[model samples]
Target: MTYVKDQSFKQDSLEISIAEPKDYFALLKPRVMYLVVLTALAGIMTAPGHVHGLIGFVSLLAIAVGAGASGALNMWYDADIDAIMTRTRTRPVPSGRITGDQALAFGLILSFASVFTLGLVANWLAASLLAFTIFFYAVIYTMWLKRWTPQNIVIGGAAGAFPPIVGCAAASGSITWDSVILFTIIFLWTPPHFWALAILKSQDYEEAGVPMMPNAKGLDRTRLEILIYSLLLAPVGVLPWLFGFASPVYGVLSIVSGLGFVALAWRVFQRRTGKPADSAAKGLFAYSILYLFLLFGVLVIETAGALILNRLG
Candidate 1:
């Protein structure tokens, strides 16, 4: 459906008439938020200190809200490009279900509320990290890097990586090496994750005038970059075990998963030029999600077991 860009006073007044609950919810980008919550929870669970039950719940909720705020701001700013890209054209802002001004207001309100509430219920360090995360994803990555450079996702990945660090700070009231390792894992993992999708969506980005890696760099270079990052990601995945924060089981699982990740990435890299990179890219993309889930899942399990044992003792 083509949405008329009606920015007149009459249209602005009709904003409430066109809006719905789902439209607002779509602003949250719930799927992406889920991964953020998982990694953040993993960081909180694995930290050496503890948080009260209520406090932990509140921190996670605040972080989720902050992530939603970032998503809203991104959609508001990218409405023009989003309307051009097939994958994003139907989003609320681009589709005209929500006005950009309303979306902007919604995001700003949530951003401030999430940060201040987290600070009050958790700690200032965690709150500050969330505040920076919102700013980075919204202003730095979304506004500047996304339009200006091929390295957009690479640098923007830090915004996604901050959740775990914030979670660690919220739980322990400070940062730890373990949380930093988690941050590094996600940071390194982001390029391969998004680049695989970028390879498939290069045409969309091209039409939208966005400088995704697959578009700015050639497909061959993009594939090589994916492989290089995948190689880096493998070792970082095992850092938790190497640093003595995880059990041998977790180490073994991480190694196995990392190898699987590398194998899939290699398959993408080895595919003959233009023969069909999608299958391999899709495989790697799917596997990357599973690989992260497995890594963090093990952390959660081990931490839960330790907590149980401690209580029993």
Candidate 2:
């Protein structure tokens, strides 16, 4: 499918949009938003302070909206490239279900609303961090790094890693080492997790002129880098347990999951051709998502349980 540079005639022809609620919601990139909410919740619950239920709920809602705003803006700005890539060609803006102007307006409104709401309900530190995250993703990453460099995912990963820090600030009005560690885990996890998918989607990226690792660097280099990052991620993933913030249960689960992540990365690194290689990359991609979800999910559960037990005691 080809993307037309000028949508003026098409816009005049349509006059009325055929978009539905789900089409607009699709612009929010809900899957990524879910991960942001989960990691942020873990940060909020694990931080060393008591946050009132209503305040906590509002803070989380504001953070979610901020994340959604980032997603919308990213889609708006990347519509041309999105139209070129098979995986993203059907996205709301690229598919003409939502106009770029509408998406920009929606994203800008949500960005302002989320930041202002968080500042009023929580603290300004959290609000500031949320605002920065949106700007970094929409402007710095989406507009610049993504098309300019192969390290796009590596550097751009910072935007995705900020949610937990924002949550910690909202809950305690300060950034703790615990929240930083949460940020670190996600930061380290991003390269391998995304590079694995990049290995699989190299052609799509090449066609779209996005400088993803596998497209810019050779696949062998990307695979090796994926393994290296996976190795780093495994040990760091165990830090919360080692530091005593999380229980032994989390420690054991983290070790097991971390090992599994490395094993998948190794598989990707070893398989160098054809269907076997593609399958390996796909396995690593899928397992990487599960690996992160398990770690944060278990951390939240363990931390919340400990808090409840402490209050009872």
Candidate 1 TM-score to native: 0.94
Checking candidate 2 for backbone clashes, the offending pairs are none
The lowest-lDDT stretch of 10 consecutive residues in candidate 1 is: 8-17
Estimated TM-score per prediction?
0.94, 0.95
Q: Candidate 2, residues 121-191: lDDT per residue as tens digits?
A: 99999999999999999999999999999999899999999999999999999999999999999999999
Worst 10 residues of 2 by lDDT: 6-15
lDDT of each: 0.93, 0.94
Backbone clashes for every candidate come to 0, 0
Candidate 1, residues 45-160, lDDT tens digits: the string is: 98776678789989999999999999999999999999999999999999888999989999999999999999999999999999999999999999999999999999999999
The clash number for model 2 is 0
Model 1 alpha-carbon drift over 4 Å, by segment: 1-15, 273-275
Query: What is the Å distance of residue 132 in model 2 from its true position?
Result: 0.5
Q: Residue pairs in steric clash, candidate 1?
A: none
